[model samples]
Target: MLFALGFYTLQALHYYSPYFSIFAVIAYGLGISVSADFVCERLKSTRASFMGRNLLTAIGAVAAIVVMVFTIKDTPPTASNANLAGLAQYMRTSTDVPGDFYDYAKKPSYSVMCSWADACKLQYLSQRAMVSSANQEIGIKGIIASERFYQATSEDEALAMLRSLDVKYVVAGGRLTVWHGDISKIGISGANPDKTVRVLKGDELPANKVGQLMAARMVWSSARLASSGVTSPLHHFRLLYISYYDSEKPPLLLYEIVKGARVVVKAKPNSPVAISTNISFNTRRFTAWHDSGTTNEHGVFSTIVPSSSSLVFQLNR
Candidate 1:
């Protein structure tokens, strides 16, 4: 009765879809119900009916599977590098893709992506909740096929999938970062020592690799001025590098922030260097935060924010 349940759910929400989710739910429910009928028939000495029920269940299961597979496979490609900047901004405020997307922050509850009848139970949860997925496969498995998650045979395919899904953020290692050139690693981990590119979501891809290299080179030049990882205990002078996929200009000199405990920085005498803070945070909902600005010639800035989890930026004196 999954179909009926979904229909009732949609009705409760005042949804107007043709009840596709309801139908699927019903089909699957029928499969199970028919199997139960078969068992009951066997108990009542109804041999012919048991066979028919078994066949019905089998058919229903196959139909459900086929419909779900087709629906997932036929989803349209969603990426367009052409207004990439604007789309990235929009996605920054969004938590998940359109199909699996949900928001219970309002009344008259509504269905988001995938199922179109009722709000997902997940919508009621707060954004601070975190779901850890150790690997791509696990993460993909957690999401419906129509969602942003997918299994690709190759890195190119995976990148293509991200583009198709208009994925705004990606978490990967240095090797994949170098390969895709679109995504960057964020924060620091013992597993990721180089601390190359961390968060790659920005307005536009640099015009060319030279621009990217320039950005990397600039970061390397100013590494001594960047901030340390949010988790770092013993702070020291750190150089930061943020990488990206579309190579057009330098990846970006996000800003040089200080790292060591109780450390302070001011631009050296006669140095006209400018700097700004790059703020970021992580919870279950939003992936990363990036806001870049410049500092006065003296290059002085500080904040008393929490050191344990807060990502900070301070330029070296």
Candidate 2:
């Protein structure tokens, strides 16, 4: 058994042919043992023979000990060493997230939009829901949907897509700030076919494309705050926005805005309900209104109708 173990160890060390080494070692040991037994049997009556046997055994034991020591010393480092102290420190500090930042944990079930890598970390630490994880276990359709949301040309389109997915808060960060020319275009075709599948120069896109992306304002940015003496990691725009576009447009202007720790929207009666929002309203004191049961082309029905003839609802987060 000891010889077999030693043979296996040598094989692991890339010794010449495992089978050959095992056979050779076993044959050599057997030959030595047989020869020693024969000689001992012949010299069984002699004290010198007993001393010689003891001396041989001692030499073999010493050789085994030396081999074991060298084998242990030559062993390579493990893969676990890749995890450094800095990595642990980074993960520990990430959990010290600001309260003012969007907290998806408050909601019963809602998705927070962020890069896949950050999403994985936040999901683990916060125990909150996310749009898609870094592992992409949500499948290809989910990946394509998220890609479309990021690649959206207008706030309306982006909000509409978010509403479709029932997403409330959108997160912006340095990892998300891709240059126009550096954005990947290989996977699925986006809304803009001409620029969809290729990295595009800034000038190549339509005039409104850049403006629409800029409109999603940064409500909180960690890097921006740190520059002004706030101690935090250096990453641009670790901001969370309520994703409101202050435009008198068709889809956006028609919905009732609900902004709290996150944002929620309720479509007016008989108005288009292409957008959806998820905000926690249980803690606040607010009156409930009746719905007219009007459904849009998207099959989204109105939930809250105004009690008074003319009413305006506004909230700050």
Candidate 3:
């Protein structure tokens, strides 16, 4: 009774155990001991009391089976440890990092994004200062700041949060149960980003946390979006590595924030031009794209950015 009725937290979401789960061994044993004699004696009779016990136990057993069947994925820390292992190794290795990264112990680099219960597992394996963690090593305010960075729907807000925290690297994955929504899927929330509108501010219409971080820069999902001309491709951040993308391996991705490449374009005088690019990335895949500007009286347009690709320019008609 205590085991089945007591609350159990899975990936930080609290729910009552419904039936005889493996975790309820003690309860099962106790129940069996008490009911075994009752079962034998009741087999000789057809009273309501005996029937009720059998029916209730049958119902509970069924409920437990349903819950267990729906959750084939493993729980926290252990959930995707294999998937996250390679990315964690990359974080710890100095040779694999960009030119800006000195060392985890030596430089304030690599942001371990937070909020999910399983998140700390990655941070623990990375073995560095996470932006925040369930351990609360960075405290409540730090955790809130991390949450905002992940949850913010606006590019400015997300960048603000990153710059504010001096976060250079961002990581994604090891979480399967998304209780919330984020544009980049970097943050966790109860909102589904697909159904919700992405806004530039928390106070904007459809005032709920939807993610835009994935769109702010290139991501594993960006290729499909860019190919379909449905997305504004990655700019401010560069992909470092990703393991088992779009698979059951439960991918782990890493990216470094950078100052993008600057490109100047010559266009009709005083006109706002549209710009796009197809960026080859991580020496593994390609990601899009860049910025735009209005030309001066001289018909010269120039913009500095983090990265770029093949450039195509069109005047805003």
Candidate 4:
């Protein structure tokens, strides 16, 4: 009675309470073993009893199998560790991540984006990003740097801030809890750039957290590059282009298009020079381009491509 009924009780209790799975499994093993021993001793001397023992054991095993099969079927093949490994493989190998799968360390450069007010993660990102090049380490940095980061508090204020910073990149993913509306105006600037810029837009309404960071990184990297003279034969002079933001980054859509463009680039010590390029969905190709026009000698090249290709620069120099 205890064997059958007790097992049922544990199963029912543990099904809804995942925390108890290990304990329940242990209890079931112990209880079943004890019950088997008691039954064997109770009928020790009878030949017929041996047959009964076999029957009972078979029944118990079958019952356990039923429970296990149901549980195993409901649980994924890669439940925890295995599931995460599969996800990591997909993130690294797949060109586009599937919706069902997610990278455990989503933002390699940031630990994990937190609530805007989470000061701890913000500080950690800024201070610890260079500690390691590993994804987990980058995540630590991302979380800390973005801890105090908020989707623009206001369109006017954001625009003003961008203007003040002479900001080259601005990510526009809005917070559902805070800036729960369209952010079209937040990235717009009245000042014309001397060089060229690109914007990428996504088809998915309401971009995900990954999209937000990808956009921010593209812009951030672009802002850091300086102009160069030698260009890749692959890229020359071109106009605005289009590409799919299919990575764990922003989603971009563009109507106008160009590819294989090149631009001048310079970077700080130990940084690679970049050449602005565009991923053209229309052509199904990523092309380099050169930034024309002129700079004020500080090498700040700025020109507008399109708002849809939010990130328009690439490294080449």
- All candidates' lDDT scores? 0.32, 0.38, 0.50, 0.33
Candidate 1, residue 22: the lDDT equals: 51
Candidate 4 lDDT, 1-317, residue by residue in tens: 76566655655444444457546655565556457757767866576456546765666666565655454332322222332223222222322222221333443222222223222332222221211123322222233222113333222433343333222222222121111222221222210232222222442224333323222322212212312323211121121222233334322221111222223343333442333444342345543433444343554443433224345553322
Write down the RMSD of all candidates, one decimal each: 17.0, 18.7, 12.5, 15.9
Error of 4 at 121 (Å): 18
Please report how far candidate 2 places residue 128 from its true position, in Å. 1.0
- Candidate 3 lDDT by residue in tens digits, 1-317: 54434323321221123242455533444454456447656767557456546765675566545444443332322335555665665666632343233244465444555445446766655555566566533423423455455545555666677776667777654332223332323322333433442333534323132224432223455434544546544456666677653554335667667666656777779988656666554446665554555799988786544452335333333
TM-score of each: 0.25, 0.31, 0.51, 0.24
Candidate 1 overall lDDT versus native? 0.32
User: Candidate 3: lDDT over CA atoms?
Assistant: 0.50
Evaluation by TM-score, superior candidate among 2 and 3: 3
Candidates by lDDT, descending order: 3, 2, 4, 1
Candidate 3 wrong stretches, greater than 4 Å: 1-81, 94-110, 136-143, 173-219, 222-229, 248-250, 270-283, 290-298, 308-317
Report the lDDT tens digits of candidate 2 across residue range 1-317. 76556544543342223355444444544444455655766877567567556765555455545544444442322213222222222222432333422444553344555545356654443434556665432323434445555555554566666666656545453233222223433222322333334454452445433323422222223223323433221111122122133212211101111221211234443453322222112123232211123444444352322121224343221
Quote the RMSD, in angstroms, for model 2: 18.7
lDDT for model 2 comes to 0.38
Which candidate, 1 or 4, would have the higher TM-score against the true structure? 1
